[model samples]
Target chain A: MELLVFLIFAFLAVAAALVVVAHKNPVYSTMALVFTLFSVAVLFILLGAPFIGVLQVLIYTGAIVVLFLFVIMLLNIGREDSQIAGHKAQLFFALLGAVSFGSLVILALSSLRPKVLAPLTPELVSLKALASTLFNEFLLPFEIIGLLLTVAVIGATVAARRPTAEESAATAAERSIETKEARP
Target chain B: MNVDVVVTVAKIAVVLGLLLQVAPIMVWVERRGSAMMQDRPGPNRLGPFGLFQALADAVKFLFKEDVTPAAADKPLYLMAPALALLPAFTTSVVIPWGPNFTWDGKEYAFTVSNADTGVLLFLALASLGVYSLVMAGYASNNKFSLLGSIRASAQLISYELAMTVAVLAVIIPVGSFHLTDVVAYQRTNTWNCLLQPFGFLVFCIAAFAETNRLPFDLPEAESELVAGFHTEYSAMRFAAFFQAEYTSMAALSALGCTLFLGGWSLPWLNYEGMGWLGVALGLGTLLAKVGVCMFVFVWVRWTFPRFRYDQLMRLGWKFLLPVALLNLIAVSAMTLAGWL
Candidate 1:
């Protein structure tokens, strides 16, 4: 039963991932990306990582993808330009990058044993055990990641802050001048 | 195995049946309660105390013509209402309706799916709830609908941060994300509302925003946005959005009851000692608590004036987020000091 479900979702994830890249509309591509993420989450649950699965959905599909959708709609992003196909050299470089990344992943996986890779033991993936492992063994990396996220958030806030009073006044003056010119 | 499947099916049936009933009945309450507050007769002409008013509205919704805009994205337009209802139905399954009971020598949990990641599951669904509004607005091909959805997306996402952290304030001391653990913790330590009033306050306020109730309901502010995301919808489609709103209100209220109000664990009510009678008694208590929450939802809506868009954003981010974080820290400190 588990294998069957895994196969179904694995196929779904692959198809959705393809759609994410290939879809013409950016908004539709984001929706397809949600499907891919959700399928991956289901795969995580199948692997006895329900906590990770839920987090995957919570963080990726729920939060990040929603933001992506918001931007796509707010900007009214249109279909992908067909002119991208004109760049053969760029396409060659992209394939070269993809191949190198795939090879690197394969090389990393080759050194790991199957049992070591995914133990599939409930104890390993359970919330308490995961928390202990993260805090004890991976605490530095986790804290560093948290710090990185905080810094990024602060940067974003600083970048998106309201313009100064003079800046707004200048813009208002510019709009008034443009309006006056159009009226004449 | 057969019994397990049967029990799950039964639990789903009961939860869905009760949840679906909450929508129509709450609409009745909203109308009648608002009318009573204003010294009016309300919809008493339909049936006994206007009991059948919801039914009449449902019938009218079903018969009304389902209109689709010429430029609307057809598939998404059709899917939005169903999407809206999905979270409402799914989030309630983790909520324990009554205490566990043994029948036929087999123990059965009151909830439908008592998964280990129950709270996380609820949060995931809560995060996705905005999609329906976004989809509705984006697909509608109408400016108002699009703007409403944009506001909804931002508002829900912002409030979700505060709500999730506020919930964690309670869950931190409990040391588990399980709903049953929450109820059990409350049973031992008077209700959580008394213990962490700040958490409760932040949670209730965030819950109001999460469910997009009034004061925070800028997404569908009728005067400004002309019915918001569902402006282009009509007939049963519009009804679906309306029902989704009420159903979600019921879900969030039930969640609040579980999180803060001791769930089915009523004060001076020892259903646990009542032997087999605890099952029915526990369910009754929970329903009653949920009923009170529902009334509160209506009352707050009628009582509060809607907040301006920036004010709503400011409240969610500047006020609620910081307060929820403080509550989390306080609770964590108390837990560490063996106070909680």
Candidate 2:
């Protein structure tokens, strides 16, 4: 039953992913991406990581995708215009990226020992176990990732912040000096 | 199916049944409560004390023309309302509304799907509710509708951060993501409101913002957006947003009651091991707490003036976010010190 459910959602994820790529309208594309992300989240649950699955929906679909939609809406982007001349370059890069990712997946799979993981049971996959694993084993990596996100947030804030009056006045003065030099 | 499967299905049925009734009950409460606050007659014409007003409203919504705007994107416009309503219906499952009971040598959980992630699933589903607003606005092909959706989406996103952080405050001390664990923690000690005052305040404020209640309802302000994202929606479609809002209000209230107010828990008593008596009393206590929470929602709506759009955004991002973060840090520190 779990395998069947996983198969169905995997199919949906791929189809919605294709829709995300192929759809003309940005809004529709984003909505398709939501379905894809949601399907992936179901796949995560089936993998006995319901915590990560819900986090997938919460962070990616909920937060990131909403930002994507927000940008699209605010910009009022219409349907993408097909650029025939750009197709060749795009196809080349897409194929190159896909082949590399596919190769990486196959390599990782072959490198792993067959049946390395024990069969998942409810008790084995409890929240307490997950938390201990995260905190004890993967603590450094987790904290680093969190710190990286904090830096990114700070960077975004700095990049998007408007100029204060003094800074604007200094820029104005620089511009005036440049004009003076050009005139002289 | 096994007994567990049958029991889970039955629980889902009961919860969904109760959730479906939230709209009418909340509608009545909001109208009458607002009426009393405003010193005016509310909808007493439909039935005694306006009890059947929800029925009349339902009939009106159902019988009226389901409108499709001339220039609207037909599929998405039609799709938006169902999208709006789905998360509202589903999020209630994560709420542990009643106590577990033992009967006939079998232990039964009160919740339908007591998944491992628990409350995080509620957050995920609740966050998805934003799509309905955005889709409704965009598909409406009207400027006002689009603007309303944009505002609503922005407002929800801003507040969601604070809300999530505030929720983390509760989850931190409990050491589990499950709502049942949260209630259990409260029962062992005091409620989160008494312990984590800052988190409770931020959560309550963020809840108001999330539900698009007054003071943070710039998105749906009549003068600005003309009924907001559902402007082009009519009849059942319009009622879908209405129902979604009320149901989400109930869901959030239930969440707050569980997380902060010690859901269904009485300070003076314990319900465990009391079998069916525990179930009845626990359920009643939860419902009563939820009712009080809903009353506070309506009371605040009637009392407060709406915040300006910029003020709303500023309050969410500049104020609530910081306070929620600080509260989380405090909770974490306390937890580390074994104080909680």
Candidate 3:
């Protein structure tokens, strides 16, 4: 039963990822990305990491993908804009890069010892256990990441702040001059 | 094993049937209830006191033409309604309706899936509910629909933060993400609402927004957006959106009851260890609580005027989010200090 579930979701994930890249419309691609994220989340649940699985759906599909769709629609990127500008050479290089990455992953897996792994016990993936480990063992890295995110948010706010009064007035004056020039 | 499978199947059928039936009935209730509040008669001609009005509406919707606009994205236009409906059905699976009861010397739970990660699953599914509106709006190839969907996405995203924080506040006292555990915790102590009134208020407001009920129904503000995201939808597709909204309302009510109103537990009564009778009574209590919550939903809809778009955004971000965060911190502190 577990294997069947895993296979189904794995197939779905790969298929959806393909659709994400192959779809002509950016909106379709974004929707396909949501599908891929959901399938991957199911795979996470199957692996006994239900918290992580839910987080994947919550953060990626629910939040990030919605933001992606928002930006896509906000910019009104039509089918013409969605089309890739490159030719056969770009496709060839992309395929080569993908093949090399696959081979590298395969090689890494093959080098690992062929020993029977311990089965997932409920305690191993329980929320309490996961929380404890995350807070205790990985506390430093977690806090650092949190700090980095705060810094990034601050930087973004500063970057996107409104122009100064002088700057805005100057821009308004320039726009009026351009409009007057065009009126003639 | 066969009996277990049969029982499980039967349970699923019954729960789903109840949910599907209740959503339409709730629609009727909302209409009638709103009419009563406004001192006007509403939908009295369809059936006895207009009870079967929803059924008639369903029949009408089924026969209506399923129109797909020429400029609309065909596949997405078709899929949006189903996407909208799926989360409501899926999220209900984890809600425990009653306590376990022994039948023929075998114990069975009232819930479909009593997973430990129930609360998280509910939140995850509820968050995905945004997709339906977004897809519908974007696919319609209409400006109003697109604007409505953008509002919906923004509204949902903003309100979800406050909702999650409020839920976290409730979780602190219970110290468990499982709905059953939360209920069980409340069985001995007071309801979370009594303990965390601010959290409950925040959650209730956020739930209203989450379900897109008035006065938070800015996404479908008819005065401006002309029916919002479903402007281009017709026939069963439109019905699907309608049904999904009611189902989410039901789901959120059930969730709120479970989290803050003590689920199936009645005050000053022990329903456990009494077998089938207890199970039945527990289920009744939970349903009654949910029904009351549903009534409150209707009452609030008729009483409050819809918020302006900017006002709605400000209320969610500036007001609710900070209060919810503070509630979370206070609850956490109390829990750590052994005060809760």
Candidate 4:
């Protein structure tokens, strides 16, 4: 039953991911990507790492993907621009990207050891065990994650702080007016 | 084939049932609550002081025409509302609504989805709710819809960080990410609100903004953005957005119950096992806690005015994020010092 569920989830994840790339509209692509993230979260649960799965859904689907959509909307890059790249170079790059990612994934799957993990019993995979591992042995990584979050915030702020055209335009007008007055 | 399988399937059906019934009632409650707060009678004209208003609203929404703009990407536009509503429906799965019990010589757990990362699972499903708005807005090909989507995506993303960090704060001290465990933690000690006040505040604020509630509801500000992302959406499609918002609100409230109020935990109950009484008490406690949180959501919605867009962004970025990080640092320090 678990294997069947895992196969279903894996199929959904891959199918949704393909939609994200294949779709012409950026909005549709983003929506497909959201589904892809959700399917991945299900796969995570099947792997006995429910915490990571949920975090994947919450952070990536909820936060990062939303940011991507927001940027797309804010830039007002409408349907026309969001259509498939028409340039030959861009197509070549897209194909290259696909090949590279496919190779990496294939390599990772091939390297997987054949040993089966112990079947997850409810008692063995409860929140208590997850908590014990996270806080006790993984203390350093836990602490470092906090610092990493701070850095991410700072980075996002810096990236979003670039001056808009309106700002530059107003500054230019003001500078020209001052130059005219000074010369007189 | 097994008892667990039967029980899990039954639980999913129950959660779905509960969501369908509760979401509409939430709409009625919000309207009535807002009306009373503003010194006006709410939907008393419906049935029995607006008790049937939810039913009425549902009928109206169902009958409403499903509209698509002439220039809109028809397939994606039609798809957007369902996309929005689906994840919102899915989010309720992770909430531990009642208590586990042994009855008829069989053990049963009372939750929609019994994944070990209970609360985190809720967060993930909640986050996916954004795609609906983004898709609807983008597909509409309307400037107003686009603007609304931009505001929603940005607002939700900013608030999500603070929300996640705040969640981590409670998770750290409790030493568990499961909704059930978090509730258990609250039941054993004082509620999480009492123990982790700062984290509670952050979660509440982020929850409100994350759901696009006022004063954080800049995404669909009618005064400026003209209904925002759903501007082009009408009839049943628009109704999906409406239901999604209310459902998301309820899911967040359920989460609040699990994280801070204690899932299925009654106040003043003795922690030590007192037989069946303890089990009954735990279930009652969780329900009551969830009820209060839901009430607070409506109360807050009516009490505050909508925030300015820039101010909303600033609050998430400047105030909430900083406070969440600081709280995390403080909690870690306390742990290091053997204080917490």
Candidate 5:
């Protein structure tokens, strides 16, 4: 049953990934990306990472992709504008990159010993265990990453701050003068 | 089939039926409830006391023309309503509607799927609920719809952070994410609402925003956005969004009940070990709690005016988020001190 479920979702994930790249409309591509994310989430759940799986859907599909869709809608980019400028070259490079990545992954996996590993027990994937490992064993790295994220957020806010009052007024006057000049 | 499988199937059927039935009942309740508050008769033209008003509305929606706008994204437009409705209906699977009952020498839980990750699953599905609104707005190809969708995404994302923190506050004390375990903890101790009152308040406010109820309902501000993200939807498609809204309202109420209201447990009353009677009483208690919460939802909608977009954002981020974080810290400290 698990194998069957995995097969179905794996197929869906690949199909969705293909659609994400192949679809002409950006909105449709984004929707396909959602499907890919969802299928990957299901695969995670099947692999006994329920928490990660749910987080995948929660954070990626739910939050990140929604923002992507929001921007896509806000901009309302036409199909012609969204299409790749160098379509053939881009596809060729993408295929070459994918093949190299696949081969690299296969080589890495092949280097590992083919010993039979213990089955993933429920306790191993449980949130309690995951939380303990994350907080206790990897606390320093986690805290550092969190601090880095906070710094990044602060930097972004500072960078995106609105223009000062005088600058805004000057720009407004300039825009008004331009409009007035063009009106005739 | 095993008894577990059979029981689960039965539970799923019952839960789905109850959810489906509640949507219509809520529609009637909202109409009549609002009318009472407004001192006006509403929807009384249908069956006796307008009890059949929801049914009539359903029939009307079914018969109305399903118009697909020329400029709209056809597939996404058609898919949006169902997408919106899916999360609301599916999120109820984890809520324990009643205590376990021993029948035919086997214990059966009332919930459809009592997974260990129940709380996380609920949160995930609830977050995904935004997709429906966003898709509906964008696919409609209307400025109002797009604005509404944008508001919805922003509002939902902001409030969800506070909601998650508040839930974490409850979870810290219970030390579990399973809905049944949370209820079990409350059964032995005080309800989380009494323990974490501020967290409960934040959660309630966040729930209001998350479900897009009044005051925080900037996405669907009829006066401003003309029905918001669903501006272009009509007929049953429109009804689907309506059903999804009420269903999520019910689901959120159920979550609140489970987390803070001691679920099916009545205060000072132990319903366990009494077999079928206990289960029945527990189910009734849970239903009553959910009903009260739903009534509060409807009451707030009519009593309070909608907040400005800025105020809504301020309430979510500046006020609720900070307070919720503080509540979490306090709760965590208390738990660590072994006071909880």
Candidate 6:
């Protein structure tokens, strides 16, 4: 039963993800991508990490997808923009994605019963466990994540400022030219 | 109880067995709790104190005609509810209900599934459950359904970050991902809630968002989405969604209790008790803690106004995420200082 459910979800995740990239309508693609994310979260749950499963749902489905929707809504990027991407290029990308993903799947399956690297612990994998692991064992990565967050914040501010400032300056120059012509 | 028999029976019954039935009861509790909170009788008219209401509802659902709209994708539509529910039910496998029992001269540990990587597994399953909603909504091809599913999916994904970070906050102090160890760690002194109040707050809020309960229930916000992703669903398909939601709530509550409330440990009792009385007390403690948490779930559902879509996202990404990360740092510092 578990295996059956797992496979069904995996199929949905992979197929829906493909459709997300393949579809003509941006709305449809975004919606399909949501399904893809959800399917993966379900697979996580099946793996016995309900905490992570819930996180997958709350983060990917709840936040990231909403961000996608918000952008789609804000840009009002309709069917036209979705179709702007060339089909030939898309097909090539799709083929590449398929081959890479398929290879990974094959590799994972081939090592199904790989030697257990870590001893089994009867832990809940809740917030506490995550904290200990990140701070104690993965301390360097933890610090690096902090650095990454800082960079992301600064990068975002810089990106936003440059575009808006440039656009505003162009508008100002256009207005000045209009005024000079009127005075002349 | 010989260890071998115990293992065989538990493997069959506990892991994927009769214990699965508990999720359905959680559905009953949620309804009763919701109805009482609203100051109106919910399903009490159907049975004594409406205890059998869930059963009656199930029967009605099963007997109802399965409607497949002309425009719907038949295979995907049929598969969607199962997809939604399968992970919800499976997430409870690693929850430790009670301590190991040494009955009639043999030791038999009490837990459904004891995977070392159980927490990660749960997260993976839940992330995938979102597909069911997205598929159901998309497959229906109805605008309202699609809109609702999109909102819901987005909502779930956003909150997951804070939720994971909150879980991470608790995990850092203990140095283990095992539920048993978390519970044991809590049992020795303070419950996690007392020590990691910030993480607890974040976890509870994130839990609400994950379950898509009210205050975060934008997905099924009837005022907007018209039943959200499952708007077109009827009969058992619809019930499955509700069941999954409640079951997910129960699973979270169990986890919360185990993590924050010290699992099955009571404040008055030391860890040495090991007889039938001990089992009773331990199980009772667990039940009481879970019940309180579930009640809080209902209470918050009633008390708070649902957040706007943008506000909800902002809260998760902007506020909760930073708070969780900072709290994690504070916890690590404190643990290193031997203050905890």
Which residue pairs show backbone clashes in model 1? none
Q: Could you give candidate 6's per-residue lDDT for residues B1-340 as a string of tens digits?
A: 5567667565457445433555566667767877888888877876678788778778899999978889887776888898888877777767777776776687655666665555655665565566677678767868788777777767777677777778877777777667877887887768999999999989888889988888988878888888888888998899888878877777778888887888888776764466767766776778778778877877887778888989988898888889998998999899899888
Sorted on DockQ, best first, the list reads 2, 4, 1, 3, 5, 6
TM-scores of all predicted structures: 0.92, 0.95, 0.91, 0.83, 0.92, 0.74
Runs in model 3 deviating more than 4 A are: A87-117, A163-184
Query: What lDDT tens digits, residue by residue, belong to model 5 across residues B197-246?
Result: 99999999999999999988899999999999999999999999999999
Per-residue CA lDDT of model 3 for B236-335, tens digit only, reads 9999999999988988999999999999998899888787789889888998999999999999999999999899999999999999999999999999
Of 2 and 3, which scores higher on TM-score? 2
Q: What digit string (tens of lDDT, one per residue) describes model 2 on residues B1-340?
A: 4877778888899888888899999999999999998999988997789899999999999999988999999989999999999989899898998888764579877887788788999999999999999999999999998888889888999999999999998999898888998999999999999999999999999999999899788778887788888888889989989999999999999999999998988898978768778888998899899989989999999899999889988998899999999999999999999999
- Could you say which candidate leads in DockQ? 2
The DockQ-derived docking category for candidate 2 is medium
lDDT for each candidate structure: 0.89, 0.90, 0.91, 0.80, 0.91, 0.76
Per-chain TM-score (chain B), model 3: 0.97
In the range A18-128, model 4's lDDT, one tens digit per residue, is 999887777678778877997888898778777677778777877878777777667766668776558899989989999999999999999998998988887667767
Write candidate 4's Cα lDDT for B147-248 as tens digits: 888888888888888998998888887776667777777776778887779988999999889888877878798889899989988877888888888877
List model 2 lDDT by residue over A1-184, tens digit each: 9889989999999999999988778899999999999999999888878888999999999989999999899988876543244678888998999999999999999988866687778877887787788999999999999999999989999999999999999999999999999994
Error of 3 at A40 (Å): 0.9
Candidate 4's displacement at residue A164, Å, is 15
Best model number under TM-score: 2
Tell me the spans in candidate 1 whose CA falls farther than 4 Å from its real position. A80-100, A114-120, A163-184
C-alpha lDDT of residue A169 in model 4: 97
